[model samples]
Target chain A: MPYYRCVVPKDSVPYEQRAAVAKAFTDIHCGNTGAPRSFVHVVFDEADDRWATPYFLDGGNRAGRSEEVKAELLSDLMGAFREITGVAEEDFSGRITEGPAKWTMEGGMVLPEPGEETEEWYSHGQAAAGG
Target chain B: MSRVSFNCTMQEGQIGEELRAELAAALQQITQDVLGESPDDVPVTFSDIPSGYGFRGGEPSTTSLVRGSIVGGVTQEVREDFMRRICDSWMEISGCTVDELVVSARDV
Candidate 1:
């Protein structure tokens, strides 16, 4: 599961744009990793004092992307935030983390090992069932 | 190369100064040993969650959650070992159950 936890300032993003923001994150993640949209999980939380200054560092997970791919994802995410939240790039920041594939679980089923995703999750439909 | 961020539920003053410093050092060591990243570069973030705001299984969560990322290609054994160390530290420091202290990692 290429899950992402994005913490934005409270009320930074308008209510109507929330769904599209999630989709944007999913698309960027899937495009970079070849993971299906169904397996992507994105949660947007409102930041509070608990988070250190520059709450965008809240965190994210990546599954074997090269630096180029990671950059692309980050760029896309920045664009999404700009569009959805009307926030400037200089004011917004985030980090994409890398995780092992075997640790990811969905519907109580663990994903195939890394580098085996092509054989197991080849398409959106097949990737969903993870057969 | 690997960073682990913990989004947890805790009231003010729940995680003490000594425990926080210890946990940070432990995680840095794990990242250095397991992922070959410099302890200095291993980024760790801890975000607090209020009790009523987070949930597990439709019930209000009484425990904390930790989700994070690591550099790709570390062996499963190493990953598990790192996870166990971090989770155990969190449990001891926060008094949260193993079940409540969820920790997962992704590779970049």
Candidate 2:
């Protein structure tokens, strides 16, 4: 399973900032994943403009900070998360797992993916003038 | 018991196959360079995933994972040095940008 599901406002912040947030969030949970960092899934969720706030917290859950400052804050949090967990983004496959789901069926390591990325279209082209 | 871990990410000229072989050779060389004899065999493994994106030079900018195991009682510093050399060689080969590297002690 993915490390954790994230809910954030899309238009509220930029995509880069969003990715950074995802990275940091995954780094924190990487410890639990047991997979280093590469394998940790940082799935993104767009908060509906209707609600106007991400559901992670209550009362506008604004993360208690402004968007401008949130970017840097997210980066710092990622670094701190890495340091605290001692998890590397690329070592997600190096998790230590006990054999045979013993003792509560502990997981979070051994992220075996299914299928592959079949499409990689660089760009789209328009139709020609008059057939 | 003792293991020698290496990563093939961010700038790579060689993949795990090359890395595993290079590591084995490198380990033997290190033993000869530092220790007197090439006492015993070492275990090593490499990871290859096509799901992630690889840089122009073949190194991955997104992220990746690789592993290797070496026998014998080698010091942490020695193991780290070996990993660095492998990482450097990989960078030279694939020219991938590395995110980070780490090692863990696994008792097998």
Candidate 3:
């Protein structure tokens, strides 16, 4: 599970940009890890300041990806942020916490171990592939 | 290392500098005491969400919401206790009710 929270200043990001940013995040995640875009959760929260910090928590599902791939995902994320917010890359700082998915839940159901796809996982892939 | 991140909704000045420091310290200490992570290693970030955002039950709420990640195999009892302590701490600090403080943890 790649749950991302985008924290930005109140009304700093345009409404349409938020959707684009979320979709961009999903695209980067899916392209890198083969996870379905549908399962991606992106929440945009406006803060009382103009600053922004994008935090990512990566479940063990992504541990299989090569380091190169992970680096590219981060690069793409920074680029996407710059594109959407018109902010310099240096102005944005974020953290990604990667941990094992020994206990993960989705759709009110605990997910199976990595590589053991659940029905929701299969459906997410199918929907992403336009099934 | 176990990680805990809190996204709480508070009006400006509701969480002053002193309170913010207290929250950060308490969260880090709790993670250390419960999860065994070093105090310096735990990263606890609090985002003060604006009024219109951060909703619960499909309605905007000025409540404290927490999402925690701990190493696998911690029992439900321990997890619940951790949540209880965390929620109680938030309520005690912010004058929020038990209902307004939401805490959920997942083993990683």
Scored against the native two-chain complex, candidate 2 gets a DockQ of 0.02
Report the error of model 2 at residue A65, Å.
29
Give me the displacement of residue B67 in model 2, in angstroms.
Answer: 2.3
What's the lDDT for residue A32 in model 1? 68
What are the per-residue Cα lDDT tens digits for candidate 1 across B1-108? 335443333433446555666677777776677666787876666655533333222223344445557656777777676667667777776675544444565554
Candidate 1's residue-wise lDDT over A66-118, tens digit each? Answer: 78877887778778767876766677677777655566433223456545665
Better candidate by lDDT, 1 or 2: 1
Q: Write the per-residue lDDT of candidate 3 for residues B1-108, one digit (tens) a residue.
A: 345544443533446657877776776777777767777876666666544433322233344555676666788657666666676676677676544444556664
Candidate structures ordered by DockQ, highest first: 1, 3, 2
List candidate 1 stretches off by more than 4 Å.
A49-59, A118-131, B1-108
Residue B53 shift from truth in candidate 1, angstroms: 11
Q: What is every candidate's C-alpha DockQ against the true complex, given to 2 decimals?
A: 0.09, 0.02, 0.08
* Candidate 3 chain A lDDT trough over 10 residues, lowest sum: A54-63
lDDT of 2 at A54: 33
B53-95: candidate 2 lDDT, tens digit per residue? 2221112224333333445476655645544554444444444
